[model samples]
Target: MDKQRDFVLRTIEERGVKFVRLWFTDVVGTLKSVAIAPAEVEGAFSEGIGFDGSAIEGLTRTYESDLLAHPDPTTFQILPWRGEIDPTARMFCDLTTPDGQPAVADPRNVLKRTLAKAADAGFTFYTHPEIEFYLLKSDKPGPHGLEPVDRAGYFDNVPGGTAHDFRRRSVRMLEDLGISVEYSHHEGGPGQNEIDLRYADGLTMADNIMTFRTVVKEVAIEEGVHATFMPKPLHGEPGSGMHTHMSLFEGDTNAFYEEGAQYQLSKTGRRFIAGLLRHANEIALVTNQFVNSYKRLWGGDEAPSYITWGHNNRSALVRVPLYKPGKSQSARIEHRGIDSAANPYLAYALMLAAGLKGIEEEYELPAEAEDNVWALSESERRALGYRRLPSSLFDAIRYMEESELVAETLGEQVFSYVLSNKRREYEQYRSQVTPFELKHSLDII
Candidate 1:
């Protein structure tokens, strides 16, 4: 008997769970679900639940539309929002073929596969994300677009404000679901909030991120406010970002730490940073996927525009925080370019791949930018050998299209589908007439 499977069954019976929701993500990181009666939970663990994949984004070809969702019992958690009456539990599912093989195009599987490669290399990856997002008054748009729940600025405290209440309720819900949050506070932008999740193994952190987005939105609905992970939701306002801190370990020893090195970063860590800088452009599609994502990257403020590493420099694409005394295990690098709206599974996979590539090839670490990269003039930055990340989604696509590393990491199924999907999206966006065009050129042209 499978202990975890049996534990899920016992919990369901003991907790009066009448519905079991099987959850997974599409290629673009949108959450998808199907609820089954309590009786079907056991069968779902063994035989798997069948679903049609014809319409799901980047899932598979429609000609062979059948797919199976095999629920991993380890992810089982009861829904807190769905009260005591017929309580619902959820488990994340892995997409599989009818023959019981892992589906190539499944974003979760893509992450799992990349993680396995790291395991083979005798390293374990860990990640912590400081997620930023905005809270709106409602989903409805006005002349000024969606209004914020509050106008609070960075770390501002507003007594009994909706943003405050929203964070409280959202944090409580996250805790109830077994996610540990390190901190929650007001961000720089109006009505923007940030919640930093404690570090966890890469796979677990990805799962936690998917759950976090859901809990925030659910609480927003209950509070009569709207929550968005959109990268650039408001014009002229700071955009939301999911800045991730990453590290690798060999058993219990942090591979990134050294006793007496510059920044206390070990040789392994330096190579890993080299890998990230070299491939940042190639993997930009997965990290900051949307066209609007570029607006945030180049929109100034805390958002990093150039590719460089530095100590405590938020203006650089990768920042190494000050090492805490007696906290050797905490030494890590923070990648700041990822927007809040990215698909966690694919994003994490490519990030791990990039870092590992650097280590494998013994890529030498570049010179650290001692001064602010964003403050430097164009010629000065070029003179220092710093490169800018993909300026737009178009440039990102061009870089990704020619990348062997990304193709191997994501597998052919996902690589082809993503390219196709993003191309269509870019074309569709270009075909539209934006308000900026009308305001600037409609009358003049």
Candidate 2:
């Protein structure tokens, strides 16, 4: 702690950092910040900076509104978009209460607690996210729909295109902030882009994801366009997903890999996948929290509507990527249902917990999907023992409500806040008479 604190302080002094932004997130994953002068940073390291918790969504009630944000010095990074002149910096914060207890509602702490459990069980969780989003001319939607900055299809390298330049700039900025990018390219949907971050530990990866979103949006606004992580922004096009690759490690070795196992996946790996499949429906409220998230899940461009697992089966909710020769260290399971806009801290925590539960209980791995699961008849799918994920936000809530794992992972405060927030959102959504209703039933009725 002293070493990281010293390093952050020295860097700030040497780089002439004027403002140090302490960053955190709300229950719904909205990024929040409070900037402090560099002089007060050292003091904040021990005492933390206080704020009104009641004003922020899901933090605390009016009577107990005082909260503190203790900056994680290891997360210190100079804001690339802020420029070098009198430069500003930022660090992720872990929230606490007035009495110095870890805030149960703090999303970062939720992941941290789950990670501590993994460490105690002799494992480390790592994740790689292939994040997808769209570049739009503006946030507004016309009668036809929102406009994409470009119409290029997947992997089409149009030199001098806005999306190409946007991606290039984003990758550079991310690198500047010490993030490693594995790949970047155009995706299937018009103006949609995908960037995959190199795998890192669960906590670091969640922090990186928060940083990644801010960088992308900052770059987009500076370039005179809007960027959205909306899972289903377009009706007949591919939806954006944060399809995550996850693995468990024990010290220097990959726990998921075995030399002669099927698909080279160890029994531990199989059990983990089983856990994910069993809990996938319940965790949908965290992984795909929004109502629109279901649109992406069921909209059929390989969005995964059923709970099953297979080697290289895109339709299956959990997929084991084909083993590459001499790449056993890279062996991992890909979860396809998580939307890009999810709260990474909470999402990763629940995912790790589910998989760990499977290991603890020795869950039986199910039959692999031999063909496109989506193409199977409904009864055929049912007979094959395939179960569908929740089709709506309310349905997801129902599943989540019954999960003891989710409640335990999120703690009482956070679990209650999330349920309340989603309930309010659904109520407001249900009361609205939409364009579809007006067009279909208004004059006819």
Alpha-carbon RMSD of each model: 0.9, 0.9
The sequence of per-residue lDDT tens digits that candidate 1 reaches over residues 1-445 is 4999999999999999999999999999999999999999988898999988878998989987789999999899999999998899999999998999999989999999989999999999999999999999987898878899988899999998998889999999999999999999999999999999999999889999999999999999999999999998888889999999999999999999998999999999999999999999999999999999999998986898888999999898888899997999999999999999999999999999999999999999999999988778999999999998999889999999999999999999899988998899899888999988999998898
Per-residue lDDT, model 1, residue 111, is 94
- Tens-place lDDT per residue, model 2, 313-418, is 9998999998898988999999999999999999999999999999999999999997999899999998999999999999999999888999999999889889
Off by over 4 Å in 2: none
TM per model?
Answer: 0.99, 0.99
After superposing all C-alphas onto the true structure, candidate 1 shows an RMSD in angstroms of 0.9
- CA lDDT of every candidate: 0.93, 0.95
TM-score of 1: 0.99
